[model samples]
Target chain A: MSDMHIDDFKHEALDHIHHHLKTYVSVFVALMALTVVTVLASYLKLSLTATIILALIIASIKGTLVACYFMHLISEKKTIYLVLILSVLFIAGLPLLTLLAKYDVPVN
Target chain B: MDIPYTVQPRPDTGLYNAKVGIWLFLASEVMLFGALFSTYILLRVGAIDWPEGVDVLNVPLGTLNTLVLITSSITMVMAWAGCVMKDFKRFRFFMGLTILLACVFLVVKSFEYGSKFSHHIYPKEGAFYAIYFTMTGLHAFHVICGIVVNAYLWGPGAKLWKKNPAQFTNRVEVAGLFWHFVDLVWIFLFPVLYLL
Candidate 1:
């Protein structure tokens, strides 16, 4: 058997840490750009449907930026990602599901 | 020679402890405010003629408060940087400025709320006012809580500042996270309550 040790694990962890720090600056710039886009989109007089859709799309981009960078979800363990995914599902699903009930009701 | 007491370093999680804890707390807060926002949207959609007279909300003042809160966020971050650099004087200075800014935010918010109260624009009457008061009231409560926490962390009686500097930074960072959340909520509230 070879005398391999846990030092390799430590070295790999350090490499990943270095990569994360390097990427963080780019992530911050992207988030800032997304914020600018959202603000600009707000100024357009799109119809209600188009406006809401565009706003939601921009919001999603911003949310992803915050989750991945500020929250460090990208570097986090898989279990944490699972928990976050579950949270998004619940937060997003409940509102849509409730709105669906409104569709089934007859309008006067 | 006098014997020096060696301070124990906090366990390193590779990230700052206070920053991590504050972010976790903010996650829950997002859910709390998220529920309020959903309620507002539902009520607004169901309203027959949405609340009129909302134009009474002072846009200029609200805009001022937004600038104040955003500036405070910058100060808070600077304070955190001071901690990383171990610059106690700058840390205290920025932290004090953040608290003052928070108080300014509260005062402006109070004026806006007071205007509503004087006009009998309450949440009890109809859907618009209901969502309006509920959302704004809850946010105001958060602002008050933030102010109190800021005072505790930066006030003269703060033990964390004297005993353990790292712990103090952690506390300030946590408070800053909450402060930023308060600002984030207002970003959404401004357009919904004042502009739209």
Candidate 2:
């Protein structure tokens, strides 16, 4: 039974690694496409809001690719994944919170 | 409980220990730079005048440095691959080239920084100069550290490349990952600080 469990685990791990490799390639290609679009967007005379929004979207995609592939978060254990998720949540929320606080004012 | 005579089976986690360790280290680094980037954004947004005239930065020089750094990344990866293939001669050659490329990058960066300093474009000039100097200064420091570390690994100091080639490959791979991260950060900074 113990030997069987070990074999099963090995198979599962290899499968996981293979699946992640495929996904990583796709994400990397997507990131390159987004980068090109972002550069093209800059040349056009888009409004400030539109430009900022597009840039942020592209940045998010790039960040996701790095976090998942280069950092190996996609293949990490559950505990590690939890830590990553918490960090992202804190990082993303802090900017929004700061922006809202800055714009808040007393109204008559 | 009586000890069992049967040999315990080792679990197959698939990931090697070094790979996992490198990823954990990278995660911490991400947080470190994340805070710096957040501060940059906050300051840029809160500024009233938006610190105009930063276009004084030499775009051609910056572009050249970008290419040099990117080429270094490629060479570093090639060095790692050479070690994996047990080609010590090629590994050393590529590592030497990587170090040379990194030095070229630093020389160009120093020229850029020197020109700014000669013009008295210190932090006291304005907020734009303040942010500009701080960011680039920090990046230059990282490049210096990377070069020093690469030299130690490829030089006679450690000599792990000769003793244990696999461990040497791991070291080179981790260093390559960090170097790539540095290049990635500059890719964003180049457009924002120079082109934009």
Scored by lDDT, the top model is 2
Candidate 1: which pairs clash?
none
Candidate 1 residue spans exceeding 4 A from truth: A1-84, A103-108, B1-21, B52-56, B156-158
DockQ for model 1 equals 0.10
Error of 2 at B56 (Å): 2.6
Which candidate leads the pack in DockQ? 2
The reply for model 2, stretches above 4 Å from the true place, is: A1-84, A103-108, B1-18, B52-54
How well is each residue in B17-104 modelled by candidate 1, as lDDT tens digits? 4454555566677777777777877877887876432255676786677667656666776665565455678777988998899889
Model 2: per-residue Cα lDDT over B78-183, one tens digit each? 6665665556787788789989998998899889888988988787787777777888778888788888878877887347655545456667767776776776
The complex in candidate 2 yields a DockQ of: 0.14
Listed in order, the DockQ scores are 0.10, 0.14
**RMSD, every candidate, angstroms:** 8.1, 7.1
Docking class of 1: incorrect
In candidate 1, position A1 carries an lDDT of: 11
